[model samples]
Target: MAKQTPMMQQYLEIKAQYEDAFLFFRLGDFYELFFEDAKKAAHELEITLTSRGGTHDRIPMCGVPYHSVDQYIQQLIEKGYKIAICEQVEDPKEAKGVVKREVVKLITPGTVMEANLLNDKENNYLATVADFEDGSFGFGRTDLSTGESAVTLIEGDLNDVIYELASISAKEVVVSEAFASKYEDTLEQQLNLTVSVEEERELPESMEGLCSELEQSKLIETMAPLFHYLIKTQKRSLDHLQKVTYYSRNEYLKIDYHSKRNLELTETIREKKKQGSLYSILDKTETSMGARLLKKWLEQPLVDRKKITERHSVVQSLLDNFFIREELKDKLKEVYDLERLAGKVAYGNVNARELVMLRRSLHQAPSIRIM
Candidate 1:
């Protein structure tokens, strides 16, 4: 084998850390991929595969422009591939030797926050499962786009956990190394989920506030692995991450996985599409946030009579006053997805246009309240 160049050495070192993802190593204006990554990305992304001259042999290489890389990333993410965005951290003019490049972000299907990639009507949830010795499991889910987080204890077998995951339509699942080794195939084959492993289970003090309301240690244990994975991959302040909500399965109406599919509550049974689902039929929500909430309500129908009655009374009030209902609808139309906007703000990715939208959404609040 030929001796590797200084830049190639750096790329190899960084690539070793993220073996599973395609490393988009930064090279000036283009984000290049080398070796197997280059070949795979070239084929998957439909980009031209080229070669870089090495000392003895040619090395496979491919790249997409940095400015237009998001489109390519979106394509790979849709195909359930992870991408490690290696960016030049230091200026070439200021660097001592090769520019300091690092993996700035790891984009997975569940962790996608880009506006163009996300669907306004739905959430992208990253879930985590922790199996206990007694046969029960802890399940936690978070929507990075919406800052919504929740954890629940499943007092059933792996099938029960799989059912809950299916209901949420999770794109990816994080689990312990042991858990992954045991159930990774099942999760992947059954739900077609991207399974990630996070060995950390201890809850850090800084994130304690996020789960302060939860008294159960099992809930904390379940949420910790997810938190660790988010912190590791995101590498930023998760300020928008809401306090983790804890819920028991008994609180909501129980529906088996088969029944959920048969009823087509969220997606059709045969086609597995959302067009003819119950959610789609009943959805008259004007805003994206309302649409998401409506789906959640449908998926987990309230079993408690008090809660059910409260929701029914609210609906009755809206029906009683036609003008008020129409006015509220108009106001809601002016509102943006506040949950996701807040998430972008915390992620430091919110642009000026989104900020203006946020302002406009806030302006509708007073009108909504009056109506």
Candidate 2:
């Protein structure tokens, strides 16, 4: 017989729903994992690998304490893992038989909104793509913490959205229920984006002829499952995405991938990002994760600008010039949150850390006052 704990049963139920992402089964003091997730996290995070005493051998198990979750989260995130934090919604002592555990948060390299898990000048983004209107679809997204919104209308090109999303690497999708099947199939075929669900009653439904056309999009059969990040952005894309071309006021920072590595945007200015201290002003109060992510993105923009810019000339004069790149890469998991940080800074919700990072990056190239 399969040994069953109330907790295990609950876990299985949630896992069935969130099949694509790792479930952090929250117990009293630790965030637990079961089966394959347990084995993977145990090996990767160096946690104590244990097991559930089941009749047929045993079920895999592993976990990290709530206190040290931040560090462990960093390791998993760095390895491109997505963790769904399932926590006890009520005190076990006051609960019936088993405690109520719910997914308090889903942590992906992108869309992180926690403190102690984020940095300054960084942004975390989650985007939604949809197929709508006569074989044509649109894409839309918003950085909740930074108020950065995006709407791009893609025409007749499903893969175009996928390619664009891949270029930007949107971390999650608020999918529509109607086109779930085709969206899943297409995303798998075209972009290799996995799927997951968040029961947000707030997600908008798609209208128009998008339903049938998208459900009928051609499917390809020979692509490999390209697993980059653990938390899935979409099983398929959700309903219809918003307009696809306009840039949000506070959008994901862009410098082209080339600029992020060799050239340092913050070489001209160097300051550490701290929370609630002198750096508090720049701390993304809306979401610190975005702040930290933005900081790194600014240091290492993803672009192909000229090698010798005036700002590069200034940064090249420093001794700890390499810190610019180090900090950038060290914080590269989800620079999506850069938009949130930008918004905060733009609205004067920041400090020296924000100013320094922005000044250095802006110095390198031409002024970027988006219309």
For 1-371, candidate 1 gives per-residue lDDT tens digits of 57888899999999999999999998999999999999999999899999998455889999988899989999899888899999999999999989999999999988998889999998889999988888889999999999989999998888889988988989999998888898899999999889999999899777999999999999999999899999999988799999999888888998988888899998998888999999999999999999999999999999999999999999999999998999899888889999999999999999999999999999999878776
Model 1 TM-score is: 0.96
Task: Specify the highest-lDDT model's number.
Answer: 1
Candidate 1 lDDT (Cα, 0 to 1): 0.91
The estimated TM-scores of all candidates read 0.96, 0.51
User: For candidate 2, lDDT tens digit of each residue in 1-371?
Assistant: 46567777898988886666688888778788899888888889877889867466788899878998888888777555677778788977799888887776666655554434554444445566555446655565545345544455566455566655555445555455554555766654454443433333222333222222222221100000111111233222222222223532123344443443234333222332233233344433333454555554444343435533544765565335676545444444323334444554543444676566556555532322220
Candidate 2's C-alpha runs over 4 A off are: 1-3, 54-56, 156-159, 166-169, 173-371
Clash count for candidate 2 is 43
Give the poorly placed runs of model 1, Cα more than 4 Å off: none
